[model samples]
Target: MEFSQKIDVNILRRTTFSPRVKNARIHVICGPMFSGKTTSLIKAVKSHQKDGKKVFVFKPKLDNRYADEAVVSHDKNEVQAYAVEKSVEILDYYLNADVVAVDEVQFFDDRIIDVIEKIANDGKSVVVSGLDMDYLGRPFGSIPQLLTIADEVTKLNSVCTFCSGRARFSHRISEDNGIVVLGEKDKYVPLCRSCYNELKDK
Candidate 1:
């Protein structure tokens, strides 16, 4: 008998590892750079604050899109936040908060996974938002790991430059050939994969 066909069905047991389904305590919001992820993150924090929960906001020190001490959305809405280069720093800043909110998570190193995991293990609601893909359509950074562990994942959308379709990637057109090029709207455009490739060919 083949191994596949010879199994004792009644005694066999199967186990699956589902991080989100098993412990859906973390929340993640991800999209392209201009997708309003920060806005959504802020709103969730605000709602928690209104409910009288202790809330804290954090961002990578490298992402100073607006102000050093605030998390700014594409629409320019700002919220007070703590800036840290490592995820462990966030633990020091918001140890007592009931909800921990993180922005620009893609800018952080992969070690952030440990920080986020530790915070979530404390039974606090963790909300993180960042670009899922870099300007070149590759995985950005630590955001993907967070997505897998998060209980809820909100994939946001940005208005595409070439059409009304939702934007899923950030196209980078730079005179300099480098992966870490960072700039405002001039260096990037919100586009779907189709539009992005079309524009990329030009």
Candidate 2:
């Protein structure tokens, strides 16, 4: 009778591990111009408010198209927001807020990303809305990175002016050299890929 070799079971023992669960999260609503990103953001804020959550809204000072201190959608839906010239200024009014909403995120500097991330990590929910791409179809400021780290992303679409197809790009009708030309229907139109490419080629 040969004795079988005994396996060392103790060596297989592993350390106890548990992943950290986060209640707070980041939500992003992004798309081209006229995609109703602000509308979605407002809806979210109202929903949270109905639940008795303390919500705070912030918008860049540069966006005074509708109101000096309010976030306004194309359809005239408006929500009061603190107008801040710098991203860090948002922290001044974030006290005891359960939910934070940011409109026109693309207008803010890159520092906005860090500020938003910090708010989320501190157990406060964050909702952000902005254009994902500029007129040239390039990723706008800080939005691409925000999309990557966001827990949820909603990409809205608009009707193409040239065609009835879903528009995913913002085409600048005006011949402006600068990237940031602040205007509404007078300057920009929504276009699908085919229509945008056609117009771009012309």
* CA lDDT of each prediction against the hidden true structure: 0.83, 0.91
Q: Per-residue alpha-carbon lDDT of model 1 for 118-164, expressed as tens digits?
A: 87877677899988998778888887788888889999888898896
Show pairs that collide, candidate 1.
none
Report how far residue 109 has shifted in candidate 2, in Å: 0.9
**Compared to the true structure, candidate 1 yields what TM-score?**
0.84
Write down the worst ten-residue block by lDDT for model 2. 13-22
TM-scores, one per candidate: 0.84, 0.88
Q: How many residue pairs clash in each candidate?
A: 0, 0
- Which pairs of residues clash in candidate 2, taking residues 3 or more apart in a chain or in different chains? none
lDDT of 2 by residue, 24-86 (tens): 889999998898999999999999999999999999888889899888898999888999999
The Cα RMSD in angstroms, rounded to one decimal, for candidate 2 relative to the true structure is 5.5
- Misplaced by over 4 Å in model 2 are 1-22
